[model samples]
Target: MVEVRHHYATVRGHRVFYREAGAREAPTLVLLHGYPSSSRMFRHLIPALADRFHVIAPDHLGFGNSDVPSVDAFPYTFDSLTDITEALLAQLDVTRYAVYVQDYGAPIGWRLALRTPDAITAVITQNGNAYEDGFVPEFWKPVWAYCENPGPQTEPAVRAALSLDAIRWQYLHGVDRPELVDPDTWAADHHEVSRPGNDLVQLALFRDYASNPPLYPQVHAYFRERQVPLLAVWGAGDEIFGPDGARAFARDLPDAEIHLVPGGGHFLLESHLDTVAGYVRGFLTAAASPA
Candidate 1:
């Protein structure tokens, strides 16, 4: 069994927490987490992939075990989050690597790839949006509304989206075996989101999420321009970013591989770790070969 190591790095004066495993000389895979969750989301997948690749998963400034600076102190926009995440990779001397992006991780991964195009070896996206078609109007209605008007009066309606019940719903709603879903996932996510003043942090990011769709053209440009190796593993039943999001990649990069896990939901990792890890490992290996 591969052992996962925990460490901290001081990036831009903030202590960044990350989980590392596998040999340093191995090909690297950086895992960027989703909202209301952190590197902890990759706990199982990290070890699963560590034998063949070095895996690094970090918690953004305000999430997980990392520093949770108030909005007053640090801006919570996607740009700021990506900046800190990129800084963390630089601090660790990780110049070239494949990144696994999910949800919030997609924006961060795309920005990192664009900023340092040569450094990104490949990309693995799981339920991370890169196209307008990925956004399900029904699920994103309340979220977009909050993004349009963010304030004290409007906060609660959007904030309800992050409530404990909602967090649990994200895990089990579309899953086949609700029993297979770990109770700990929502527990940890809820704990982090429930932290003092963390609601403001979430609200800030939700508002910033509006800034993402406009950049879809640029993200698509990267795929067309660089033709970066992409492996998309998606939960087919995800009500938020449905299977359409997975299929949308083919329009840009016809060669990109797409795998849909049946009976999976938004947090597919929780229920489909072994399948994802297998797909990721195989894709990376195939991508490394001569065409």
Candidate 2:
């Protein structure tokens, strides 16, 4: 095992914090975490895959220890996040990497793969949206409503979503094995999201996500046109996005290899770290192995 190194990369004026491990020349596994949380989501999987790959996990701006500039200072759009992610990867000299998409990571990863289709060798999605029919929770309704009619009223919804209890519920709601999730994990997410004006980032991003409905068609087209191999690991129990959404990936990406985790949630990557890592490594290795 290699010693993990924490560092910073200035992107769009945010000192984006990240952890880099594994040899520079090794295959890179780029991790895109969800909103209201940061690279911290990948804590368990990072070490599992580090020995075989260069794992790069960054705290998206306004999330984790990364920047939290005023919502006025930043757009908080998924497109903007995609831009920042691309710039950071290029600046770091990462080439031909596999994207590990989880939660909000799906949208960000979709935009990245669209722009630089060739840069991606494969994609591994764990409980991320690639299909349209997956189960979505009741909590997302208010946020979606606000996205439709964004205004000062949207502020309350954002505040509600970013609330400590709300975030804790999102992280731990569907876990079959509750003990696997440490209270500290949710504590850290709740704390980071509680930062001043941090709630606004959540607001702005979710608002922009309302506009994201159109992008999915484009994303579907890109996957079809590029034939990018995808391995979707879904926790059927996820309250956010359900089994139907997981199967939806198979609709657009007919060949997308799907792994349905019997009991997992938004944090399935954490709960099924070894199984997910094994599936991902196998996909990457087999794809690159000329078979």
Candidate 3:
């Protein structure tokens, strides 16, 4: 793993943590991880692509070792996080790049696409969603309910979401079996959450996400009409955002390729790094053609 480094953008008033891999001049590939999982998710994927492309993986403000202030102080909304990403890209002078987004990053990354259409040359999504059909996870109901009235049960739930055990469970529970991942990864993520006050920010982000699902239609529209080449690499065993969710990306993207790993979960990168890396490389190569 690359040593932790900070990228401070006066534009956003926060110091973000990121690790840049491969050569600085290789075509850029920005890897945006999901909720609660930091840039660390790209540990394996980064080295694989480092030989050919510049790989950047950043911890979203609340997820990893980046700045996580009180929920009252920061705009933990999906929209604001998208803005942070845009600013980071601009700060880094990345003009055209492929973005790998997953889970909660679906909305934030899509918002970035909407805001900066030309800057994103391609997309790589694994277990991320933008389809009306992909909305059936039972875990989301509480989040939606809390967003409608974020008063009584909000604090406790948010606290729950941030617990070390909670984040660990979210990462591990749905796997076909426990050996799908190295125990050290779980230990590290759990340790990250064990830090005080991290969980509330996580739950707060989820609570705010309740209102942002409406952005899907425009994202799907852009994918279809704009012909962005998307590689939807998903694990067939993801109970949270199941295989059909992977098909949903293909539905919106005519030029999309969907790859399914028979025994993977929300954290497919943990188990299917080789296939994910292969698809990303191939997709980036094919997506560079003039549309």
Candidate 4:
């Protein structure tokens, strides 16, 4: 069995926590986690892939075990977050690697690829949205409203949904096998997000998320221009990033492999870990084959 090890690196004068497994000589696989979660989300996936790949999963600056600086010191924009993550990867001497992005991880991964084109070997997106068609307004209207007016008046509705109940809902919603869902998943998330000043950090990211959709054109152009290897594995039951978002990848890169996991939800990894792991392992193997 592969052993997962925990370590920390100083990026931009802040301590960032990460999980590492496998030998250094193996191809690197960097896992970027989603909202309300961290490298902790990839705990099982890391060990699953560690036998054949060098897996590294890091918690974004404010999320997970990383140091949560005051908003005054660290601006909570995606750019800033990615900059810190990029610095962390560079500190660890990761020259080339594949990125597995989910939820907020999409923006971070895309930015990493854009910043260092030659560094990214492949892209694996799980329920990570990067298109206009996938940004349905029904679920995002409240988010948009909060973005438009960032204050207490507009925050209650958003706050209500982000409570422990909502965090639990995020994990269990649309999941076919509720028994497979772990209560600790949301419990840990609630503990992290409910930290004294963490709400401000989350809200900042929520507002900054609006900046991502406008860049979809650039992201699409990069996919077409670079002809980068792309694999999209999405949960069909996901409310935020639906099947449409999963299929949109094929439009940009006709050769892109698209898999819509039925009976899976946004937090598919929670319930469908082995299934997604199988897909990832096979995809990486095929991607390494010579044309």
User: What is the lDDT of every predicted structure here?
Assistant: 0.90, 0.81, 0.76, 0.89
Tell me each candidate's TM-score: 0.98, 0.94, 0.90, 0.98
Q: Is candidate 1 or candidate 4 better by lDDT?
A: 1
lDDT of 1: 0.90
True-vs-predicted CA distance for residue 57, candidate 4, Å: 0.3
Residues 11-57, model 2: lDDT tens digits: 86788999888888888899989866789877777887788889999
Model 2 CA deviation exceeding 4 Å by range:
135-137, 151-155
Candidate 3 wrongly placed segments (more than 4 Å): 1-11, 153-159, 289-291
Per-model root-mean-square deviation over C-alphas: 1.0, 1.6, 2.5, 1.0
lDDT: which is higher, 1 or 3? Answer: 1
Q: Which window of ten consecutive residues has the lowest lDDT sum in model 2?
A: 130-139
Best by lDDT: 1
Model 4: per-residue Cα lDDT over 137-237, one tens digit each? 66788888988897888788777666999888888777888899889999999999999899888888998988898778889989999888889988888
Give the range of the ten consecutive residues with the poorest summed lDDT in model 4.
Answer: 132-141
What are the runs in model 4 whose C-alpha is more than 4 Å off?
A: none
- Cα lDDT of model 3 by residue, 157-215, tens digit: 65666666766666675566667677677677777766777666766676777656677
Task: State candidate 3's TM-score.
Answer: 0.90
Quote model 2's TM-score: 0.94
